[model samples]
Target: MTVPSSGLRSPEARRFLNDRLDWNLLRTFLVIGQEGSLSRAAARLHLSQPAISQALKRLEEQLQVSLVIRRGPRISLSSAGQEVLQIAAELYGTVSRLGPALEEPAETVTGRVHLLSISRIQSRCYDDFLARFHQDYPQVELEVDVLRSSDVISALLQKTASFGLSLCRTPQPRLEQRLVLQQRYAFFCGRRHRLFGRKHLNLADLQSENFVSFTSDQLGGNLSPLTVFRDQQGFTGRIVASSASLDEILRLVDCGFGIGCLPEHIVAADVQAGKMWRLPPGDGVSDVNVYLLWNREQKHTQAEALFLERFEHMLLTTELGERF
Candidate 1:
C-alpha cells in the first residue's frame, strides 16, 4: 500500500495500517485483477466465488475505497484499484523472493519442475540439454506432459506449469517467451495417395487435392502460417480431417485421408520408410518457431530457476540453424 507523505508519518498510524491489512486479501485482489473476473480468480485460487467476493469487500472496507467496478458478471479495476494492484504486485514479488534469498546453497536442491509441451518435439539441442540437465541435477524431479499449444499457454497462465515448449502465433502479455527452435514444414502424402509416385509435379498439380491438418490451422490460430500458405496456393479442396496430435495427423495423412503439412525433419524417417512421400514446393517451405514459455508473475523455485538459467545459456550460445 502506498501512503501519502503526511498520512502514515506517525508510527501508530503505520502500525495501524500494517496490522489491519491482510496479506491474503492483497493476494486475492491481485488474482482478481489479473483474471478480470471474480469467478476466474476463484477458479485459479481454488476458492469459492463468495469467498473471493468477501475478501475483496473486506479489503475495500479496510481501505475505504472501492477497488473494483463490477458490471454484470465481469469486473474491472478502478483508478485507486490500479494503483493498489501495482503496489501489491511489487510487494508480492518481494515476498516471493524471500524463501530463495534465505535458503543457503546445498549439495542438492530437491524440487519438481513440471514442464508442458506440444507433441513430437524433434530437436537435437533440446535432447542434449535434457540429458545434461538430468545428469547435473539428479535430485530435481522432472515431470512433463504433452498438450496442445493453446493448452500449454493456458497452463502457463494459470501457473500450473514451470515452463512450456510450444508453437506461438503472437505474444502473450503475462508470459515471457523465447524462440527456441525453427522448424520447416512441407506438404506430404501417404503411399496410398495418387500423387505418391509422381516424379514431375508442381504446385498446380495438387490444386484440387483434399487436405488434412492440425486443429489449430486457421487464419488466427496457432498454425496460422500454414493457413496463409494454403490460401496463397489457391487450393480448392476442403479440409477433410484435422487433429490436435501430430501423430494422429500423420496417421490420417498416411491412411489416405488427405495430404498434410508436417515438419520435414520430424517425418524424415517416415519418408524414407515409404510410409509418406514429399510433395511439391519442397525447397521453399514455411518455417514455424517453437517458443519456451513461462509466466513472469509466477514465483519460481531454485530448481526451476537453475533449469531456466541452463537452458537460456544453451540458447544464447547455440546457433539457430544448429537447433534443428
Candidate 2:
C-alpha cells in the first residue's frame, strides 16, 4: 500500500490509521500538548509517565508522523502535531458536550407531548408550569385533549396519551399516579335560580333543590367523592341535568336547569360577576383529587418523557395548597 509521507490523507494512509489508531492515544497527545510535559500530562490523566509516553508513540506511529518534539525536561508540538492538535481540539469539543447534551436533552426535544385531561382544570400552578415549560422547550409541541377522568385513564392505559390529568379515586393497575391537586367542589346557582344570592343557607336548604352535576358524580365513578359527600349531606334532590363537560354543566346551571357543583376557583370570576352564586356550607364541601397519570409500560417519546419528568419534579417540589 502506498502511504502518505505526512498526515493520514491518502486512501492507504487513512485506512492504515483507521485500522490501528486508538482514541486514547489521540487523547493522550492532547493532554501532552496541553501540559507541555509528559509527566504533567500523566498526572492530569492519572496514568503513569511511561504509559503516556507509549500512548503518544503509538499515535505518532499510526499517523506515520511525529506529533511531539521532546526536549530534556519539556515537550513542544511539531508542525504536524500543531495541525493535529487543532483537529483534536475540534473533536474534543464535540466529545466534551456528550454529557451536558445528554443532561439537557429537553432543550432539543422536537416533538409533541399529547396530554389527556379532564375539563375545567383551574390550577394557576399548573398553568404557570406549562407556560414556563413551553418557554424552556420551544421546539416541543403541546397538545391537550379534554376528556372525562375515566376516559383520560383509558387513553393513558391504551398508550394513546403521553400523560394524563384526571380526577382519580383509585389508582388504576399499570398506571403510575401522582396527586397533582385537590380542588374543593362547591354548590353554585345561576342568576336565574331561586338560591342565587340567598345567604345564610344550610345543607337542609339545598336538600329539596334540584341539582345538576358531572356524569361521573355517582358511586363507582371517578368523582365518587362528590357522590359520597352528597349522600352524607342527605341531599335527596334529583339530578336535573348531567354532562361530562364542565362548561356544559355550567351552561345548564346558568340557564336555570338546576343547581350545579363545580370547582370554586374555576368560577371565581363568574361568581364575582354575578353569573354564578356560591352556596352555603362553604367549609365542609367535598374535595376531589386530580392526579397525574402515566402508563409505566408505555415507551415515551423524548418530549413526552421530558415534560412528564419536569412536571413530576414540579409536583414534588411545590405544595398542594400552592398547586391548588
Question: What lDDT does each candidate get?
Answer: 0.85, 0.81
lDDT of 1 by residue, 123-179 (tens): 889999999778767888999999999999999999999999999888798988767
Largest TM-score belongs to which candidate? 1
Tens-place lDDT per residue, model 2, 254-287, is 9999988888888889999989998877773788
List the pairs of residues colliding in candidate 1.
none
- Residue pairs with backbone overlap in model 2: none
For candidate 2, the clash count comes to 0
| Model 2, CA-based lDDT | 0.81
Error of 2 at 168 (Å): 1.1
Model 2 TM-score? 0.66
